[model samples]
Target: MKKSLRFTKISVLLVAAISMSLTACGSTGPKGGAAPVQAGDESKLFGLSKTETPDELYEKAKKEGKVVVYSPSARANDAKKTFEAKYPGITVEVFKLKSNDLMDKLIKEQDAGLFNADVIITKEVSGAVGEEMVKPGRVYKYLPEDIAPNVDEPFRTKDGYANYLEMRTLYYNTEAYKSAPVSSWWDLTTPEWTGKVYLVDPLSSPAFMDLFTGMVVNSDDMKKAYKDKFGKEIELHGTENAGYEFIKRLRENKPVVLKGSGDVLDAIGKAGTKSQAVGVAVSGDERKIEDDGLKVAPIYDIKPKTSVPDAGYVYMAQKAPHEYAGKLFIRWMMGEKDGKGAGVEPFNELGSWVPRSDVKSKNAIPYEKLNMWTYEAKGFYTNSAKVRDFWIKLK
Candidate 1:
C-alpha cells in the first residue's frame, strides 16, 4: 500500500509541471504581434505597435521644455496661459508686432541664426511670411478635426503646411448709411460716397494690404467701365503728373490714413461728428465700435473699393529653440480644445467673422463668388521691398 501511494504522488507532480509550462507559453506573444512597451505597461494602446496622438505629442514636448511664438495679433498672453494649463510642464513665450514689423523681425532673426521663433500666428498673408522664414520641409503639418468643420478645403494645404483659420472683413459707418443702401460693390465709388471714404495705410498693415489687393484685382473691370462712362479715366490715383500722382490723389483726397486699426475704428465711430469719414475699417474692430454703442456696419460688395479677404494663419519655425515645445504648441492651438465647435472661444468668432466657408454674407462678398478678388500675399510680400519703396514715396 505504501509503494502504490508513492507512485500516485509522483504522477501528480508530473501533471503539475506540464500545466505550468503551458501557462508560460501563453503569456509570450508571437514575434510580429507583440504588444509595445508603454510607459507603465506592455500592452499597446490603440492596438498599434507605434502611433502617438497630439496629446501624447504634447506630453513629449512638455518634457523637452519651452516654445517661443511670434504673431502680429493681440492677446498673446491669454493664448499662452491656455496652452500652459493644458500642458503642465512646458512654457510658452510670444513676440507680438505689427504685421510688417513681424516680417522684418523674422528675416533679421533668421539671418542672424538667433533661433528663437517656434510658432507664428498672423494673417493669411503671413503664410507668405512663413514661406520666407522656414525651409519647405521644416514646417510641421497639423490640422485638428474641430477646426476642420469651419474651414473649407481650398484654404488648407493637404499636408497642412499653410492654412487660413480666421479673417477680418471691412466695416462702414452705420449712421451715414442708415439702411445700408449700398448693396453692391459699385456703390463705394459713386458720386454720393465721394470724399466720404477713409482707408488705413495699405503699405504698413497686412490687413489693409489684403483689403487693397482685393480692390485692385476686383476693380480692373470696374475701372474700365467707369472710364467709358466718364469719357476719360476715373483717375483713381489721379489724372495728375508724374511720380506722386497716386500719392497726391491719396493724400489730397484727405483719406485720414492712420497708423493702426484702432485709429480707423475710432475715426469711424465718431464719423458723424469727426469730419464725416465714411471709411474702410476692420469688420472685427467695427464690432467693438458698435459694442460701445457706435453705429457701424460692414460692406462686402465687389466694387473697386470692396472689402478684401482676410485670413489668419499659424506656423512653426525650423530652427525653433524648443523644437518639441513648438510642436506641442501647434497641437494645442490647432486642436479640438481650442477649435470652433467644442464650446471653446474661437478667435474667428471673437473677432466677429465667419471662419472660411461657402456661405455668403448678406452685405459681404463670399469668397467663392468673387471671381475678381484674390488674396496673393506671396506675390505682394515677396516683392514687399519693391512695394514698400513705392509705398514710402507715395506716403
Candidate 2:
C-alpha cells in the first residue's frame, strides 16, 4: 500500500512538470500576445468610430450632460456658445491657452491623474503632442463618419483629427517694399536684411520651435534653396546643416526677438513705416491690411517651401468623464455635416485653412498652388531638442 501511494505522488508531479514546460514552450511573450508592448485597447474607453452619427452620440451625450475643452483658439468661446445653443442640455466649459501652455497644463493634469478635460484642440506642435500625449494613451483619435470623407488621408492621423491648417509663415512690410524685398529664406540671413528682420522668441514659443525644427528636418530643401539663392553649395560653419546654418546666421544678424505678435506687427506693419522689416510667424495676416490699417503681406513665393503646415488638431481625452459629449463637441467643432456647421463660423478667418475641402479659406492665396511641407512628428521629435540647444548656446 505504501509503494502504490508513492507511485501516485510521482505520477502527479510528472504531469505538473510536463504542463509547465508546455506552457513555457507555447508562449514567448509575458502576456502571450502578438503585440506585447503596444498601448492597451482603449477603444472601449474612447468609443472611437467613423459610423457613429451625431444623433447617436447626442443621445448618450445628453445623459452625460456637459463637455470640457482645452483649446488654443481665441474663438473657443464662440464655439462654446454655438455648441450650447445646438444641444440644449449639454454645456461647454472652455479653457483657452496657447499651444505650449495647453501642453504643459495637460501634462501636469495627466501626471496628477486629474482628468478634468474631455477634449483638447491645440495648434500642432506635432512632436511634443505625439510624445507627451498620444504615445502615453492620454489622448485618442476619432473623426466623424459624415465628415471623414472630405478630409484628406494625411490629415487623419491614427492619434487625432487635423481639423484645420495654419502656417509658420514669413511676412514683409508692404509699406516698406514694393514687392517682397527678400525672395528666398536665405535672404533673411544676409547683411542687407540684418537688423531689419523681426521675430518672436524661438525658445519660448512652440510655434517658432515648430518652424525652426521644420527647417532643420527639411535641411535638404534648405540646401537647395541656399544654392538657388547664393548660386553655390552652402558652407556649413559650426552648425550641422543648412537649416541650422540659416538659423545661426539669422541669429548672428540679430533678428529683433520681441515679446508678442503685436510687437512684430507694430515694427513691420505700421503704415508708412519704412523699416523694410520682415517678421517671422506670429499669426497676423493681411486682414490687418483691411481692418488694422497695417501693411503686412505673407511671403508665399519664398523658396524651401512656402510655410510649415502648422495644423490645428482635435483629440478626445483618453479617460474623459463625458466621452460621448467630448466626441459630439469635436464633431461640432469640425464643421459638422456640410462644413457649414455653426461651430466653424467663429474660426473662419484670414490665414486659417479648414481641413474640409468644402470649407473655403478667407485668405486669398490658392491652397493648391502654395508649396509647403507636411508636418512630420517623428522628424521634429528627433531633432527639436538639438535645435533648441543650438539656438540657446548661440544666443
Candidate 3:
C-alpha cells in the first residue's frame, strides 16, 4: 500500500512540473514563443526609450560580442568596419548578396531554426520584407530615439523602421546630346525615342516594377505631366490610368530591354559609342561615367521631373541572437553615433539619399530635383502582384 502511494505522488509531481514549464513558455512572449509581437508592445521591447542613454545600450550590445548583417550592398562591409571600430570587442559580420537571394536565404535559414542574421538591409522592403518577413513576424521593427525625430513619417513605415531613398534618372550621352533629349517622361514614348531608350526589364527587377507602380499610384501627376507636355489631355490606351497608358506606349516603342542596370549603363554611357541611347538607371551610376571614359549626364533640369526615388529598408531579425547589438548597429547606420557617423559612410558612396533631414547627398542631382516617392509598404505589397501580371502580359 505504501509503495502504491509513493508512485501516485511521483506522477502528480511530474504533471505539476510539466504544467509549470508550459506556463513559463507561454508567458515568455514572441522571442521565446516564436510568435508575432503584440502590436502596441513592439516599441517598448525593441526601441530605447527617450530616457535610455547610448551608454546603457552599449553595455547590453557589448555583452552580445558580435552581430551578423545580411545586405545586398558590399558597402555593408565598410559599415561593418566602422561599427566594430565604434564599439570595440563587438564584431560585425556581413553577408552580401542580391536582394532576392538575401530574402530566400533568410527565410530558409529561419525555417530551419537557424537565426543567424541579426539585421537585414535591402531594397525590397515594400515587397519581400513587408509581405514575406514583416507580416509573418520573422523580423522586428526598431527605430532608435536619436534617429526617430530626424526622419519624417513618410520616409518610414508604420512600425518605425526607416527606408533610405535611391534615385533613378534618365542618362544621355553628353557628346550626342549637349542638352537633355527628353524634357518630360512622355518624350520617352515619342517617335524620336522609339528605339533609342534603354531600361532594365521590368519583369526581372522589383525596383523597376516599383517605379512603374509608383507612376500608377501617382496617376494624377502623370496626367498633369502629359497635359503640360503635349498641350492636351492624355488618351488612355486600353488602360484606366495614364501611367499604365504611358508604360504601354513606351513598351510598344520597343526600348532596348536589358537584364541588369549595369549593362544599360554600359550601353548608354560607354565613350565614343555609336548608339545615341538614353537609359534609365541609378543616379549613382554617374560615378562610373568618368571612370569608363564616358561623357554621360542625367537630365537634372527636366520640367516636370528628373528621376524617381526608391527606398531601401533596414530591419532586425525577429529572434536575433544579438538583439542589442542589432539595435546598436541600426542606430549607428542611421547616423546616430555622431552627426557624421562612420556607419553611414559606405551608403554615402552610393550617393543614395538618407531619410535624415540633416544628412545631404553629394550626388550631382539635388534632392529637390528628383521626384521622390516614399514607399508605402501596404500599397507596394498589395499592388506588386497585379503590376507583375500586367508587366508579364504586356511584355
Candidate 4:
C-alpha cells in the first residue's frame, strides 16, 4: 500500500511538472549561428549578441547569479572552483551524483517542466535515459563549432546539439601483473585475473557503466565471429532464459564491485607495486596511479575489447524558469577557453574523443577510429532499464 501511495505521489509530481514545461514559451526552438570570434579575441566576445556569442547570452551570468550543475564525478567541487575563479561574479552549485540519479533527476525535472539546472556534466547516462528525454540536437546544441568539428563523430549529434568531449581514460596497474600477459580489456574476464579484478558499480559510476555498456553493445561482431568459428549460432540475444543465463555467467566472473571509480583508484594507490587488484580507472586517476611510481598502463585493445569514447554533453530543460540562462550556459560551454571554465582547453581532455581534429588528443587509442566494434547506441539508450534490472537480478 505504501509503495502504491508513493507511486501515486510520484505520478502527481510528474504530471504537474510536464504541464509547467509545455506552457513555457520559446522552450523548444533553435538558435542561429554566432559570429566567429577567433581564439585570443576577447573583444569581439564582449560586444556580440547572444545570437553571436555565449558571452552576450550570459553577459549577466555573474548577476543572474548562480550556475547549478549535476555531475557523475566526485570532483564537482574542484571543477566548480575552477569555473567560479575564472568568472568571479558567478556562483557555482555542484552536485556529485551517480549517473542513475543524474538521469532520474534530469528526466523527472524535464517531465515536470522545471528548469532548475543551468548546466549538467554527466557520465554516460545517455544510454539509459537519453531516449526518454528531449532529443539532444532538438533541445541543446554544440559550442565552438570550428573546434567541435574535431571531436569524434560517434560522440556528437550531426546537428551539433550535443557535443561529446574527452573526460578521462582507463588504466590498469602494470606492476601488479608484471609476469602475466595482460594487454587487453578482455584479459580482466579471464580465469587467471578472476579474483584480482575490481570495477565500479554500473548504477553508481556513469563513466564505468558507459564503458561496460559500450562493451556489451559493441560485442556483436564477436558474437557473430564466435558463431562462425564454431559453425553454430552464438546466442547474444536469445529468449529471456538465454539472456539471463549469459548474465549469470558474467556475474560468476566475480568482479569486486566498489561504489565509485575513486574507490578502485584508492586501492590501486595503496597497493603500489604490490597491488593485487587491477581495475577500470579514470585517465586522470590513472595518471596519478602512474605518477605515484606504480607501473600502470591503459589497455587500448580495439578488437574484442574495443574501447568506447568518453564524451560530455548538456541539455536544456523544455520548461526552464531560467531559459535564457540555460541557453547561455550551453553557448558558454561551447566557447573557446577564453570564454568558459578557466581555460581548461574547452571540451578536449585526455584519452577521449571530441569532434575537432586540430586540437591535441589526450588519451585517444590508436585503431579506435576503426569501426571494428559494433557499438549499438540506439540499443543502449532504449534498453537501459531492462539492462539495469538484469544487472540487479544478477547481484
Candidate 5:
C-alpha cells in the first residue's frame, strides 16, 4: 500500500512539472503576449532618432502599421480620419476618455506590465504628465526636429512635449447686457453682479482649478485690476493674495456653481431668461451662440484679461508598441509633415487655438487681440494640492 501511494505521488509531481513548463513557454513576454519591440535605443526605426525626415518616418511608421492613442477629445476621431487618409498604409486607433480616467487606466496597465497605448493626447499637463507619467517614466520625450522650431515657447514644455492652447473666456447674455457690462475681473464681485455670475464647480474640474490657480499666479494683474476697478488695492480677507481675495468675494457673492460649462452656458445663455448671469466658458462654446440661438457673447475686450489659455499636450508612451507610428502621428498632428496645414483641422473645428506660430487661429477674434492669461504648468502641478485644499476650506 505504501509503494502504491508513492507511485501515485510521483505521477502527480510529473504532471505538475509538465504543466509548469507549458505555462513558462506560453508566458513569452510581459503580460504573457508576444515580445514587445525593445525601445530606449536611439534609432530611426524606433522613432527616437530625429535625423529621419518626414517621408522616412512615414515609411517606418507604415511598416509598424498601427498606433493606439488615448485622448480626451472626440476630435481624435476626426484626426484619425485625416491621418489615415494621409498615410493609407497606417491605422490610427484612438480611445477617447476623460483625462483622469485615461491616466488611471494607463497607470494601472503600466503597473500590470501592459503597454497597450502608444500615445496620449490630453490637456492634463499638470495632473497627469507632471504628477504621474513623467515621474514614473511611463512616457518618453520625443520632439521631432522638423516640428520643434514651429512650436511656441508657452506651448512647448522643457520635458519635450507640445501643447495647443484653448481659451476659457467670460461669457455674458447679450440681450441682458446689450454689450458686456463687466470690464474688469473685479466687476463680477460687486453688488450688481452678485448672485448673477455662474462658473463650473472648481472642485470637480481640474480645468477650473487650473483657471483659479492661473488667477493666483497672475495676482499682480488681479491686484492692478482690483485697484483699477475698486479705486483701491485689494484687502485680503483671510486669504493669501488679490486672486484669493477675489475668489473669496466671488464665493461670498453666492454665484451659481454648476457641474459643467454646458450647464452654465444653458443657464446664462438661454434666450429670454430673466437672469443676467455671466459665466466663464470656453471659446468653442461661442459656436452655440448661433447653433442654439443663445444670446451669449464672450467679454473679449475686457480690461486686464478676458480669458485664460487652457493648453492641451501630447506624449508618447515609454513602452510604445508602435513607437515609429506614434511619432509619425504626433508630427502629423502638429502640421509638420505635409506643410499644407493638414493636421489642425480637428482643432479648428473645435475652435481651439494652435500654439504653432505658423498656424493661424480660426476664431472670430484673433488670438493676438484677446487679453489672455497663461497657466504655468509646472507651478500648477506642484501647488495644485495646496490650492485645492484651500479652495475646499474656503467653500
Candidate 6:
C-alpha cells in the first residue's frame, strides 16, 4: 500500500555487489554515516536482547521507558495503545508516513548521525528496504526465535520478516455489480471496460510499478492467460512480451489514471454510480467499504493471479537507543509465541493478512487461498523503470 520508486535490475545487482564489497558483508559500512560497525563486533550495538527471553528484554526495556517507531500504517497507534496497556510502564511512539518518506527520513537521520528510531515497520521491498536500508546496514532484522516458525516461509527474508502481506490488485464497486465483473487481467483490455477502469499511475507508486515489472519477468503467465481468454496466441507489438502487450491494449482502452489508491477508490466506490467501474487499489484499503460506506470488494481470483503480493515489514533500527524495548516490541507485535498478543489485534482487520500461520484473520477470507504470486524483488527493483517508461510513452 506504500512506497515510491524508479530503478533497474542489472544496475541494482551491480550496486548491491559494490556495496557488499565496500561493507565486507555489512560489517564495515558507515552506520548511517556515523561510526563504522565492525562486522563481528556489532554486539554492543546489537545488544543482548536477541538471545534473551521476552521477560528479560521486557524488564530491561521497561527501564528504557519508551520505544520510537516509524511505520506506514496508522494501525501502529492501536498497537501502541494495546502495548501500553499490556506492559503498563512502557510506551510506544509512532511516526506515520508513506514508505518513501519514512525511508528518506531514516536515511537522512543516519546520514546526519542521529539514531532516534527504535523500530520501523514500512514497505518498499524492492527499492528502499532491501537495497537502500538493509544492504547498507541502516536497519537490522530481528525475528523473535520463539515466534519465527509460526511465520510462513514466503514472508521471511534475510532483511527481515514481514508483519503483514498486502495485495496490489483489482477492486470493483459492489453496488454496481453483484459479483466480480472481470475474471482475468486480460479482461481489463477488452472493449466492455474501456474508460471504465481506474488505476493509480505506476510512475507514482512503487507497488504498481513493481506489479507491472513482475508481469514482464513472468510474462509466460500473462501469455497463457491471454490465450486462454481470447482463444488465440497473443501478439506483441513493439513490446517485450505479453505483459507489455497487455499494458498496450489496456492503455488503448483509455483507462482513467489517478494519483493514489484512495483517489481511485473514491472515483469508483461511490454508491448508485451507474458506471460499472473497476479500480486497481491496495487491498488494505478495502476497509473503506465499512469506514467510508463505499461498496467495494476485491476480485480475489482474477486469472493468472489476484495481485502481486507485497508486505508491511518490521525492522529494528541500527544502534537503537532502546534496543531491549525495540526487541520486546517486535516480539509483541509479531503476536507473541501463540499469535494471540493484543499488539496484533488492531492489524487483524479485514483487508490485511498477517504473516503468522497460527494467527487467523478476523475476517473470513483466507488470503492464502486467493490467487496470489510471489514477485521477483530483483526484477522489481531494477526493471520497473522499463515498465514506467512503457506507461509514460504508450500512445
Query: Of the candidates shown, which would achieve the greatest lDDT relative to the real structure?
Result: 6
List the candidates' TM-scores in order: 0.65, 0.83, 0.81, 0.65, 0.81, 0.85
Query: On residues 119-220, what C-alpha lDDT tens digit does candidate 4 reach at each position?
Result: 566544534333333322112333343344434454333322333343323456566656434544444545776777777787754455555555455555
The Cα error of candidate 6 at residue 305, in Å, is: 1.3
Ranked by TM-score, the better of candidates 3 and 6 is: 6
Model 3 ranges off by over 4 Å: 1-52, 111-113, 156-160, 301-308, 365-369
* Candidate 2 segments exceeding 4 Å error: 1-48, 284-289, 366-368
Checking candidate 6 for backbone clashes, the offending pairs are: 8-382, 9-382, 27-39
Pick out the ten consecutive residues of candidate 6 with the lowest summed lDDT.
21-30
Residue pairs with backbone atoms closer than 3 Å in model 1 (clashes):
124-311, 185-303, 198-279, 300-364
Overall lDDT per candidate, in order of appearance = 0.48, 0.71, 0.68, 0.48, 0.67, 0.75
**Candidate 2 residue-wise lDDT at 116:** 84
Off by over 4 Å in 6: 1-15, 18-51
Tens-digit lDDT track of model 3 for 75-165: 7787888788779989999988777778778878888998888888876633546545554556656665556666655543354355456
Q: How high a TM-score does candidate 2 get? A: 0.83
Error of 4 at 174 (Å): 2.1
lDDT of 2: 0.71
- For the record, the alpha-carbon RMSD of candidate 6 to the native fold, in angstroms, is 4.6
Q: List the residue pairs that clash in candidate 2.
A: none
The alpha-carbon lDDT assigned to residue 395 of candidate 3 equals 66
What lDDT tens digits, residue by residue, belong to model 6 across residues 1-395?
Answer: 13334334465567667555222121211233223344665332332123557788788888899999999888889888878887878889999988888888887887798988988898864455777676556776677556756777665433456787778888888877889999999998988989989999887777887777777777899999999999999988888799888888999999999999988888988877744899998877877778888878778788887777778878778768877787778878888888998888877777788867799976567756767767545556566667777888984
